[model samples]
Target chain A: MASTVSEVAEVTRPEQVALRSSLWHEAFLRLKKKRLAMVGLVFLLVMAVVCFIGPFFSPYASGKINTAMINKPPSFSHWLGTDSLGRDILTRLMQAGRISLTVGIASMVLSVSIGALLGALAGFYRGWVDQVIMRVADVLMTIPGLPLLFIMGAVLSEWKIPTDYRIYIVMVMLSLIGWPGLARMVRSQMLTLRESEFMQAAEVLGLRDRRKLFFHLLPNLTPLLIVVATLNVGGAILSESVLSYFGLGVVPPTPTWGNMMDAANTLIDFQKRPWLWVPPGIAIFATVISINLLGDGLRDALDPKQKR
Target chain B: MNALVEIQNLSTYFKSEQGVVKAVDALELRVHEGETVCIVGESGCGKSAAAMSLMRLIPEAVGSIVSGEIWFAGRDLRKVSKEEMRKLRGNELAMIFQEPMSSLNPVLTIGEQIMEPIMEHQGLSKKAAQARAIELIELVGIPRAKEIAKSYPYELSGGMLQRIMIAIAISCNPRLLIADEPTTALDVTIQAQILDLLRKIKDEAQTAILFITHDLGVVAEMADHVVVMYAGKVVEVSPVVELFEEPKHPYTQGLLRSKPVLNQRRAKLYSIPGQVPNPTTLGESCYFHDRCDQCLDICRVKQPPLRDGGDGRKVACWLYEEESVRGQ
Candidate 1:
């Protein structure tokens, strides 16, 4: 074994590369086999591309209104139809997709960062620090999320917050509601992880607390974090729509999926003209269901205990 | 010359919900340079606790070191600063734990895990550390070193993980290696291989080993000296051959009898009746008194001190108390 090692070294290097691509590479392969998740991933990519680029190709790309053509039915000129403002609904739907997807993804990032960090700190430190962070989480959790978001949105509007900054604030609001749950989950997982033998092994290895927390601790929690973050994006989109229906999120002229549905919410449009509400409704539905499918696939794939 | 490591009158206490438990008390041990000292005891008998105390890993959260002096290489470990302790922990004094399955970070590559201490202590660059990690992996006798290093813990068997754990422990060439039941979690075949690997490391590195195990067979195989513990107190300490030839303490005697001999027939194997006493209410008496074959009246109410019985042996049974008086 010892004498042949020098000769074996050359061949071993390439094998090491194959081995290093390990868990994530394995997870990706597993995920590829799950057809529903693949479809979801493909649809989301296509939706993202169309939402970001499709509006630029439209004849009425600028959404210039024509009062005489108000609420026109579907035709070759407009694939979906014209809305109450006589803007092409297909272009508007694509435009709205951009804002909704952005809010979903941005808020997911915000919440996950805040949640995972606070939770890990609480679990690791676990004395007064745990008490303080968990109590705050508990307090936030006791109050209904919708009502609290409503109060914050009402405050944002009452303060005459500018329209351009509202999406950013709405992202912040969604994260504020989202983190408490994620933090609590992370904290509980961290508590169990702290008791794991590797932690004691880390202490013995004399790795600094900072390295232990980030490289050792946080990396282990990535599977949990990824699954939660994807799920959060879906939830964030729905919450933004709910807030938009109440005229609090990304108001008119912004073309958010929520406000588009709000535009056609009256009894006449709901009963007679099915075109307006249906497109934005389908946009929200497709984005959420795909996210859920992909998230579930990731959960199974990344799980260590998951059998083949 | 002074021994490599000397632990004097160490007492560690834990404040559990039930009450205060003396996890390790009146513990005395010495390991010379390159010597292997096997701490033999039943489960929960404070063998692991004593090993952790040497590395300053005991009394971490709910436990406290009530009293002790851990002298290592002319320095008292108990008095060192946290930074000094940390520096000493893996660089000069390293540890290998039981349960290799859970002892390694499941997410990390074996190379990354082993490279951690090499980088931290040796101040090597990442590339240098990776080369050193592969070297250490091969040094521990794992073939296809590069391939093994890149593999995750979950992919390996119990014995292989234990070998990696040993590789990590010896990466910095520590002066004293603590093995806390390192083979307890492996089957017998893997157990022998780990033992062999550890013995080879001890000889090659000239590193002292404080080996903790419940198996007499392991003690007979690896120990230069033996320290027999019962309920957190050292009952006997002797040279390996003398310990087997003329075991002194009643507890030691019972332990020897319990091992089944090869090609011998018996209706039943001898097992010491009862178990290690509960930590919370371990009274001041011979901890082995309840299960001792020849218990004196004094053994019920008065704890026997670990009396030296000449010829580099110490036994904590009242039966040997007269020998201390005669020698004194």
Candidate 2:
């Protein structure tokens, strides 16, 4: 017997168009209407645009600190107030946004690329390859990420690496260590997608494994990878901040959110002048929260099971 | 038509933790140009694996072609570089899948999916490829071709998605189409329509089809030749009519008998006595010996060779010794 849709049309295509027009499109459009997700999208867009443009209009070059304006409070001249070392807080904040957002973006790119590649190979091949890759991932998972980052930073510092390049060193460290969890998630996703009929079809069509992984299998994984990449940016930013708090991030003169908090700890400076902590702290909170919200929204939207 | 695809002693084995899993063992079949050959078996019978091995799609590290020659259009597939194989996918050969819902890229629109192979294989201009995509959509019987071409995978129903997949598969006008249970997920009436669509494509495009399925009904509906697989081995190969009317292999007989007849008043429907042996945990004996109604001591002691019966028919059974001798 024919299906309900099939009864309405003899060929497959018309029935699909009718069914889609009546159901799937409406449901998806309704979900895209979520207020919080849209707000999150706007927030992310603003932050991205502002940061992208921040370096261009920055008042002072990133390295220059004004000695005369040391530790000045918030005013019309210095919107976020001067830091302890007299850099324009606004300039420093913008410059720091460049570093923060770059670290977040770069580390995510590195991690996701490495993670997705390894994960696809592991999950698609399975057996010995899967066992070896997963076991290594398991070992990485057991090691606490923060402590590992600290140790890596200390080792790199002891080696007297270039001070200006310290932040990049930290980013690489975070990516190398951070990839295991994302890799595991990606591996499972690849595992699921590998068994999908599309993948089999690709194989039977004489498509190579690499092409199938890059095209058929990987495209299906976009939603999961997107969510993970967003959250990963948040994670990478936090790692940078934490590393900086311990004096391992972009050397002392360079203003970072973590360095701002680190500077605040001296002589109850933060309590006396509440403005110092608030600006960088708010920046950190705003960026992280918006990314998290975006991730959450995407997770909901891409999920095939969840109804609007 | 000359043979467009030929296989000789193709065996694909996986090195698993438990043991060596032979997913496709000594499978030999041929599909002439514009022919439709059905590789029919229940799940885990390695019909899909045989298809995979032909393309060398199984990962070399985990699974290897222990011994085989897969010649497609007179080229040895095993000797070709991976780059050449990828180029072959949408150019000389393409495939349709069982579940259309999962097969089409969810993020891509129908036009983009159809356009991909045209652009990749044929290097057609954007406008030209898009025009071809629309034509393909119409060719597959999709209505409102322009409008439907703009929709994403999730926007289409199962049957519609299958049609879209058909459009994409036939985009490059490949010579051979390996449709692995192409209509298994579709409704019965949709299955008929899809089978018809496939037959029409085969005739019009002159594309050979390596159809994989377990359904005898689907085989009768579409196949010109039939290969019955049991536990990774091809037990019988014959013209579809002969295979259905006088099947030589016991397993084929069992499979044909297992199909539920129309309005039959029955205490029980016929079924193969045991579940297919898991490939990872297979034994040395005849793959079907444990469940075969005609099992003898020799059947349990050793696997049977796929010996020729007569008139392009082959059977792997001890009972076919006289026919096997005549062929030798």
Candidate 3:
């Protein structure tokens, strides 16, 4: 009976607080109260900040080979221990994170741009334009996605794709395939909202069609777009990792999580050494979970159906 | 006062899956300066279509004003470029739609929506526009004008939102205001309030109003001159008093009699039997011939042109042709 009273008190307290907050503010408060999501957010933020700031303050350069402390275990001197090639796991993880996060952000931007543009146009114009765009989307969806990514990567590599230019190529390919789903969703939403009074009001106000589409219609899509992009970044990062694991993405010495895992596969001397697998595995899991949590938080925040 | 808006021989046809529907066929009407003209018709009678054509707002792909001369503010609107039409929309003339709840931008604050016209047409400063918005809100009888200006359309009540819409429409102070069924969706008391507000606003602003509605009670309350439409054509037009006292067109008389009055009680409420003829199937004969009472034999064979009644009124019926001939 006492516990039931306490539970009621717990639920009632937040509702009182929620009444005082705006939509976004209420979402942020709810997010802050969620332990797993909060932990994920903090972890992602720390990782990003460290990756940005640590490179400038490091004593050892990224390419600098330290042969003396090769394969050292966790100790006072080395917190996460050394890699097979004597490189600091802490430094390597941070450096690798920079590439992973960059690729994740880039691909998300490209995909969202394509998706939003197509979605808005398809929705606004409808009829033939809608039909043609959706048919192309259907064809793309039928193709096995991962296999297509593999084939594209291999073809690009065989054609001597530049090491510096490979990340951009991967981003483009992923974006090209990724936009259809988002576009279809946005198109349906736009169709429903197009007949709404606000659009008619904009027309009557003599706003140019372009301005109406972007300013009035586009802002309404922001929350959904944000949610989709957050979730997609995790998927894109995971896909890139898988490609790199198979030697199709990010060529040698790029310091990626996948490449680190690949190196673990070839380490013959340490049969009992789980040191090499642990760090990279943790890095991948941490990033994916962080992105997913952020996406969930955003969905809750933006959904009009959610209670304040 | 000269005619501020003259729509002569205007025909708007829409291409639908069913066939080409004549939404507005040879609609001729005029709105003189500072006059309150109301167009009354049942649903799908092309009253709204005629209004949209005046603004050149008919969607181009499926719909087109096939032939028309829309003279507005001493210029032919049909000849104007799209850019020029845009300039005319919010600057020279403004329109208030039927559903105020849907017509307002949901994301924008009431102040911003009102200020858009000021910024676009008048080029007022944000601070000045904000001040003007509050003033306009107060003019529309919204209490706490300053605070209400910060609220979104969804946050306000239905009556409050409609008032805000009127505020936006009148912000630029256009010479003409077109209201399409401004009170159709509101409750009875709210409808009265809105109609009263519109009448008061028109008197205060001295702006010529082109009001479109299906409700005869509204026409009685608001119209100075009334145009009666059937199918897609104007069946009768006269001064409000003349229309009520002696309606020449059979359709107009039928419409006036169909209403349930306060002082009269009958076995059943009068109604025009049969549905309005579909525009696609309508021939050159009188559109309302099937349902019109006192239909002459010639009514089914030939359509009647608008004939001037003895008084300052127009009736498109063969019975009024003798008066038309005598006047000529």
Q: Could you say which candidate leads in DockQ?
A: 1
For model 3, residues B1-328, the per-residue Cα lDDT tens digits are 6799998999999999878999998988899887899999999999889888888889887799999899998899999999988988877788888888889877777888898888877889989999999999999887678777776666666667788888888888878888999888776766787888888888888888999999999999999999999988889999999899987888888898899989987999988888888778778788888988787777887888887766879889877776544344
lDDT, candidate 3, residue B250? 85
Tens-place lDDT digits, model 1, residues B164-185: 9999999999999999989887
At residue B140, candidate 1 shows an lDDT of: 82
Summarize candidate 1's per-residue lDDT along A39-138 as a digit string, tens digits.
8899999999999999889888898988988998899988899999899999999998999999999999999999999999999889999999999999
Model 2 TM-score relative to the real fold = 0.74
Task: Give the TM-score (0 to 1) of chain B in model 2.
Answer: 0.96
How far residue A198's Cα lies from its native spot in candidate 1, in Å, is 1.7
In candidate 3, residue A222 scores what lDDT?
81
User: By descending TM-score, how would the candidates be arranged?
Assistant: 1, 3, 2
DockQ, prediction 1 = 0.39
Cα lDDT tens digits, model 2, B42-88, are 88888988887776678766888889899999898989988888889
lDDT tens readout by residue for model 2, A140-251: 9999988888788888889998988887887888889878887888889888877666665555444456656787777767778888998999999988988887887776
Which of candidates 2 and 3 reaches a greater TM-score? 3
Q: What is the Cα-based TM-score of model 1? A: 0.91
Residue A194 accuracy (lDDT) in model 3: 83
